[model samples]
Target: MLVGSPKVRMPPGPRGPAALNTLRLVQRPVESMIGWRRRYGDIFTVRLLVFGTGVYVSDLDEIKAMFTGDQSSLRAGEANAPLAPVLGSRSVLILDGPEHLRQRRLLLPPFQGSAVERFREVIAEVAEAEVARWSVGDRFRMRDRMRELTFEVIVRAVFGVTDPARIERLRSALVAVIDSQAVLLVPGALRRDLGGVGPWAAFQRRKRAADALLYEEIEHRRRDDDLGERSDVLSLLLRARDEDGRPLSDAELRDELMTLLLAGHETTATSLAFAFDLLPRHPRVLARLRDELAGGGADYLGAVVSETMRIRPVLDAAERTLTEPRTVCGWDLPAGIRVYPAILAVQHRPDLYPEPGRFRPERFLAEDPPPYAWIPFGGGIRRCIGAALAQAEMAEVIRTVVERVDLEPVRPEPEPVVIRGITMVPRHGTPVRVARITG
Candidate 1:
């Protein structure tokens, strides 16, 4: 059993000058986390301008306990308040306790089971169409292409919108809101809408325009008598009822839909971009993956996706704020302290993954990593609801690309990973050349 004095103050960490640590975090998150772990063991604290003196834990057992702890003891929603401007106050990402559960349940059906299976054809079709647009010898940023492809897929399959003009309009509005999100990283930028000029005002304007479109879509769905015939996520959400037999309010629907659209496409596209970047660098792995695809085997493809996420997770860590005082890794942390499960650090630990820097999909096929050791989508009840769809989308895209076209890195050296707002993406956006199409 674990042993430590309960009265000990919070774990050892950087007594930071705040701004420096925040800069390090934004600029070089993986390097900073790993460096801290080496100096302070598996758990440590770092203060940021927004979240003061937050504790970061890389120990797998502690991460498991914290994620599985009672809802009352940890508040993920409160910890994620910084995301409120983009996702809205009622989004599942920002709802706590019973409300989160209710919204999650209402949102779960469309991304699970048969509903997810039905999306496979749509994903493959989109991938094929997007891949067809690339010409041999063309050098392009794979992330940008993946973003366009994933955005188109989500806008059609998830939003239930098929009109070309309406899809383009939604896409433009979302891009404005997404592109302007870097302002949130400025610490106090989310506090209020200045409403006059500059980035904050621009963000508010973009958000208002996007929200107007979403609210209009929700209202239209509510009034549509043929909603039962639709297969999109919005349609499923529209049909959902709580135990009390109540449907979601228009605001609630807007929050959830916006949450899915933003979260679903961006992260998955980044992951795909990383996979494309990694695959060409390791020719043997690429050959094996292609062989697996040709043989109608999917296990290797799944492993590739798993390894990609494990190696280069988009989010550096999953964070939660303590709602009740608790002891973790022998340190007594008070309520309101933000605790982060260092996903990137833990996944890169040499003990958990031998030769941690190598891109080896076979590592996943050899043996499953321990429970919390492989948390690309996070853990416990608050795990990503779009996990299934994301995995399926990645797998389908990889298969389609490998089967149809031959791509190689534009340069022999790999591109560096850089932070884009909350996600880590290839610095040059994974530029690659389409050597040729096999068929």
Candidate 2:
């Protein structure tokens, strides 16, 4: 799409010191986005140390056009380079143009609805085991439990790592990398390896260890005699081939595995954490969800997950780079500009969602939600590959936990949202007390 140069203009935005902008973003990104949208309108610019020129878009029509825009013009891989250190430079998340399409097409089949459905039992079993270990009547951080639960499910169902020793080994290495908190390139000497001892050094060590295990797994899976018959994601990936019939190389396989591991676990776990935190605090929703779960139907359970993500999206925005000058949302964006789909702002729009502040699952259940309106899994071609799997995991886990026990918020008020790594999670991990164990 092209527009007259006179009609196309740079969107209005905040002009400030980069450090101040970065600080506001780091401190309260969701709030900052909403404030910026109000101040600067539907589309605006935010300059951060990380993203040189960030343009955020929240209008539904504009988001739809941008998402479905020419892939060559809107390159997500360049915008997602910040994740390359962890997901790898070859990861589908960090590849653009024909290369990105090749990776995405090859990676899409295993995460299809039918393939993900086969793992419901795995999700249930993992969630049940974790929930069972929770001590009744004691306050605990739900995020910790959810993280452990999601990580185990991913290891078993995605990697097919059922062996106790291997599972523990992979788990240890992965946790070290994930918990390091500098994967996205933090500031100053902290972002560099200081004689192999500081945060950056520790991250480098953990990443190396994790990479070793992942490479070993890839090599083993490639050699599996019954690789085609295996139902795990890694096995499916092993069998996947491009149009030219070439299989993924060890490096490609390793990066994709890392993408699935990092993208799949913490994001889902954080969503589950938010669900658990929100459910007990809003007794009406909890009671209704339990009533639906008792009937062995997930219609309402699905709505609850949708509502939770709507209210508390784990990731605030998704970024795309303007590879060529293009008109987006009436703003003439230049090449090299980073355009962000403001998920948090769009999801919370009062016009789209009445009483947007309140926790309401009925909003989703009552109507066919508008497109590009509730994009927790993002939208269009660059949408999350594991969207179906993530939602299924959330439903099964929530079903497993709610049916097995009763819970109450440790504090009367809702937990404050805080930025943790790439995800926005509950500040105190959404503390909760188990009132009783039903099963």
What would the per-residue lDDT of candidate 2 be over residues 1-439, giving only the tens digit for each residue? Answer: 2322465456878789778988777777767877887788888877778567778899888888878866768888776677777888889988888898899999999899999999999998888878878778878888888888889988999998889799999999988876665555566546778777776777788899999999899888879898879999999888888999998888999999888888899899899889988888888888898887787777899899899999899888987877788777766687777788899989888888988879999888888679988998888888999899999999999898888899888877887787766678888888888999887
Q: For model 2, what is the C-alpha lDDT against the true structure?
A: 0.84
User: Against the hidden true structure, what lDDT does model 1 obtain?
Assistant: 0.87
TM-score, cand. 1: 0.92
Tell me the tens digit of each residue's lDDT in model 1 across 303-394. 99999999989888898887777888987788777889998989889999998888899999988998899988888878999889999999
**What residue runs in model 1 are displaced by over 4 Å at the alpha carbon?**
1-8, 14-16, 183-202
Model 2 misplacement above 4 A: 1-9, 181-204
For every candidate in turn, the CA RMSD to the true structure comes to 3.4, 3.2
Q: What 10-residue stretch in candidate 2 is worst by lDDT?
A: 1-10
Q: Give model 2's clash tally.
A: 0
